[model samples]
Target: MIRSAYSHPVAEVEITELSAVPLNVVELLSKAHHPKAGAVVLFSGEVRNNNNGKEVAYLDYEAHQIMAAKMIRTILDDANKKWPLNIAIAQHRTGKVTVGETAVVVITASAHRSEAYQANQYIIDRIKHEALIWKCEYFTDGSHQWGGNCSCH
Candidate 1:
């Protein structure tokens, strides 16, 4: 499914909602694939219809595009330092996202599953925490709320 090849080991950072999350899982996997890589982990964050019992209509995301990419790259660098990863990628979508649509994707490849899984988790957690991205949840009942803090909910 990889339509094209990538030259970099890390392919993270994107801000757009123009054509859906055009990220090809196969392509991401292939990008991380290596002769020595034994595991590849991928995470997809999708928009849901409900949040905490509220009927959700859609999610609107905004980001300081340049800052977001910079922060994401920094997170990836930290992950690389922590794990023996072959390749890793993280991408987020901006603009309006509807139910069942993917809002973000993260992939990690390593020599073992443990490293790949942990790195993937670290990358996502950092992106959510450090990136300058904001999300607004619009409810079906004609209301909306901004969320992006470290809210436990």
Candidate 2:
């Protein structure tokens, strides 16, 4: 269940989304375009080939969909309140994702680069810590481990 606390008119696109398909950065960026926005920032988190000295094979992501979506929306709403943003979107991928594939994308637009950059980072950081999402990493050595999306631990 996506939720927003903003009093302004909402954007045409959903603020937060959890998808099973690969994220399309181009499409998302296009949606963020605004005539008043002088700056647009995009952050894409991709699956790497190695982690903790292990040759990573791929990753499988799972989330409590309703709760995760809600958390992401809240993060975006908080960011909007803190920054003069034109548009903000956060999208996460679910299920198996191969190396080099994007797992999450955050886009933010504003009248200036600083606010856009800061808000983009803030939204992503909060989502990492607050969203109810988990990731399982598969290694080439036939081993696997599961952990929360947050890297803080």
Q: Which portions of model 1 miss their true places by more than 4 Å?
A: 1-22, 148-153
Task: For model 2, name the residue pairs that clash.
Answer: none
TM-score of 1: 0.82
Q: Distance from true position, residue 42, model 1, in Å?
A: 0.2
Model 1 Cα lDDT, one tens digit per residue, 40-106:
8989888889887899999988888777777776777778777877777777888898888877888
In candidate 2, position 39 carries an lDDT of 94
lDDT, each prediction:
0.73, 0.85
In Å, residue 145's CA in model 1 sits off its true spot by 0.6
RMSD of each: 4.9, 2.1
lDDT of 1 at 142: 93
In candidate 1, position 70 carries an lDDT of 71
